[model samples]
Target: MSTVKEAVDVEVPLHTAYNQWTQFEDFPNFMEGVEEVRQLDDRHNHWTTSIGGVRREFDTEIVDQLPDDRITWRTTDGDTRQRGTVRFESLDDAHTRVELTMDVEPSGLVEKGADALGMIDRRVKGDLRRFKEFIERRGTESGAWRGRVRPGDPGGGLI
Candidate 1:
């Protein structure tokens, strides 16, 4: 397993940043290599991505979430095995710090090589940078889901 951590400071309120993140389907707009994301439910998402010429489809489940604080997810079924979390912290009323930490398992030599070369790390950093630009330019979320998800929640969100 390889881990990557990145953070960015955006000139938006914490809720703005956090809300934008909850709109999973919009990730393709700012997340490079992500082709599509479909929200199956509040806690389930289907993702299609092409990275380094490799196309993959995956089902991911949100494990825990807290409005304006953090969201965590793990791959449920697919060609990818990974887990990650994104956290939002208020720098001030008009500034937010977004942090992401991911753990990925490389399936083959090509992926392992890329991971060793720091490609994954760079990708994550670039993604965060793009997210910063995207949210800052919009100044508001395209959509949002404010339901809370605590540990042990059956569906990963408060109903």
Candidate 2:
């Protein structure tokens, strides 16, 4: 698996950032190449995406989640297998740090080449930057959830 790690500081409270993130459908608004993300249930989703010019579909199972803290997911079906987690860190009352780590297997030579050259990392970083801008401009969360999961427990199984 090839991994990419990126983070950005957002001008929003930790809860705002974390809550907005739970709105899976909103991802495509800021995330590049994420054509669609439909939350089938609290712990399951169907995703359609095009990365490195290759279109792919997958069903992801959220193996663990902790509201306003972190989320973990794994692919259940697809040409590629991926697992990742996103964490929210509070910088202060009005600012939060969002970090993401993803491990992926490229589906083809071109995709592999792009990964080797760090293009994927750049792309993911860009996505985070855009998300930061989008959220900060609004100055309030688009939505929110009060759920909380302690560090060790899997809050929900796949979402």
Candidate 3:
């Protein structure tokens, strides 16, 4: 497995950064190679990507979520097998740090080669930078979800 860790400090409040992240459908706006993201439910989403000419689709389930703190997910079924977390931390009332950490298991030779070449790390770092710019330009989130979810939750948690 290859692991990636990246972070960017955005010029937005913690709540603003966290809220924008909850809008998974907007990830394609900043994430390279992510073609689309469909929110299947509060804790599940479908993702489509074309990385290095390799196309893939996958479904991920959010295993743990705490508003303004972190959101964690794992692949439930897909062409990719990985787990990741996006963490939100307040630096102050007007600054926030967003950190992403992921463990990806390469499935084939192409993926393994790319992982060894550090393509995943570069992509993740670039993605976080774009996210920072995107959010700073907007100055606010397009939507918000303050729900809480624990591992194994069937999707009904209000705080």
Please give each candidate's TM-score: 0.96, 0.89, 0.95
Model 3 per-residue lDDT tens digits across residues 1-159: 788999999999999999999999999999999999999988889999998889999988888999999999888888899998999999999999999999999888888998999988999999999999999999989999899889767752222
lDDT of 1: 0.92
Error of 3 at 130 (Å): 0.5
| Residue 50 in candidate 3, Cα distance off native in Å | 0.5
Among all candidates shown, the one with the greatest TM-score: 1
| Candidate 2 local Cα displacement, residue 159, angstroms | 16
Off by over 4 Å in 2: 146-159
lDDT of 1 at 101: 95
Please identify model 3 stretches exceeding 4 Å from their true place.
155-159
The alpha-carbon deviation from the true structure for residue 94 of candidate 2, after best TM-score superposition, in angstroms, is 0.5
Better of 1 and 2 by lDDT: 1
Which should have the higher lDDT, number 2 or number 3? 3
Clashing pairs counted in every model: 0, 4, 0
**Which tens-of-lDDT digit does each residue in 63-141 have in candidate 2?**
7678888988888887868889999999999999999999988778988899889898999899999999989988877
Compute the lDDT for candidate 2.
Answer: 0.85
Candidate 3: C-alpha lDDT: 0.92
Which pairs of residues collide in model 2? Answer: 43-158, 43-159, 44-159, 62-158
Quantify all predictions' global Cα lDDT against the true fold.
Answer: 0.92, 0.85, 0.92
